[model samples]
Target: MSTHTPGEDVPVRRIDRILAFMSLGLLVLSIVCFFAIMIGSASGADMSGGVWPLIGVVVYIAPIVAFALMLAVLIMSFVRRARANRGG
Candidate 1:
């Protein structure tokens, strides 16, 4: 026999929900910064006002992807919790 706790996988009761939300917010922040950096890069050259390829790209790519992942998991947890609560 297997035993389980109530709201074990539930988003409302899980810490991941908070983490996911935080991740999403941070990702959004990164995105905003990314555009700014990219525009700044576009304007000039490295030695003469160019964008830093490594830093700018990382700024854009990492947060967006991370936030998506976090949001996905958070949603899943919430749905799972709702389903369990409903005895579905």
Candidate 2:
């Protein structure tokens, strides 16, 4: 007989939620920046003032940051499940 309820769902940890959101947000930001750069280049728009530099950096950096955050989330989740299965 199973001790757990079939309909029960595990609650997400606060850190897990925050990490997931941050990772997703960064991924989206990187994609938008990438498209903006592509369109700007295709249209020969001046891309050297105001927020352009910041956007360029984001296009390169955001995906890396997001990947790292996602890796962290995965590791934490693995540890949590391991502990739970161990009856900790």
Candidate 3:
């Protein structure tokens, strides 16, 4: 029989979980903003003619930032796993 305890199977770190939640939140926000921009443009709401357009640009960048954060978390998790395997 396996000797591992229940708690020992949890491989994800707390920080990783936090980062994941943050990434999810950013994804949701990006989706909402995308739809908003699409609907606004379709309705001839001047999406590209005012301050709202600047806000749209910021919203568009959120997913990119989220991706970078997730990539960092993945790299960190890999490094952690490697160190653990090395018995350090």
Candidate 4:
């Protein structure tokens, strides 16, 4: 290990499991909404002929993407820690 002190640049932190869990839940919900809207658009009703459906899709994607990105960061952090422990 180089002579760099841990707290100098990378500060110690706590992993908020509750926040992680909530993010995962939101991500799942958004994904479900995305698919639901997509299918509904493809099917009958033909609401607004399509404009409204596209708009709905955009609205749903934001939250889901945000949650997914947060999850990815958590996963990556875990993997990195594991690798460090194993001297990889």
Q: Using TM-score as the measure, which candidate wins? A: 2
lDDT tens per residue, model 1, 1-88: 4476673644354566667676777777677767777677688646234445655666767786776778777687767777787778
Candidate 4: tens digits of C-alpha lDDT, residues 2-85: 664433332224454555666777667666767766777688656666565665765577686666767776776666666655
Tell me the TM-score of model 4.
Answer: 0.41
lDDT of 3 by residue, 1-88 (tens): 7554333432788899999889889888888888887788788886657767766876878899899889989898878876765557
| Models ranked on TM-score | 2, 3, 1, 4
* Model 3: residue 27 alpha-carbon error in angstroms: 1.7
Q: Per-candidate RMSD vs. true structure?
A: 6.6, 2.5, 3.4, 8.2
Whole-model lDDT, candidate 4? 0.62
Per-residue C-alpha lDDT of model 2 across residues 1-88, encoded as one tens digit per residue: 7796434445689999999999999999999999999998899888988788999999989999999999999999887776666667
What is the alpha-carbon lDDT of model 2 when measured against the actual structure? 0.88
Q: Estimate each model's TM-score.
A: 0.46, 0.83, 0.75, 0.41
Off by over 4 Å in 1: 1-11, 45-54, 75-83, 86-88
| Alpha carbon lDDT of each predicted model | 0.68, 0.88, 0.79, 0.62
Put the candidates in lDDT order, highest first: 2, 3, 1, 4
lDDT: worst 10-residue window of model 1:
45-54
**Backbone clashes in each candidate structure, one number apiece?**
5, 0, 0, 0
In candidate 3, residue 20 scores what lDDT? 86
Model 2 has a clash total of 0
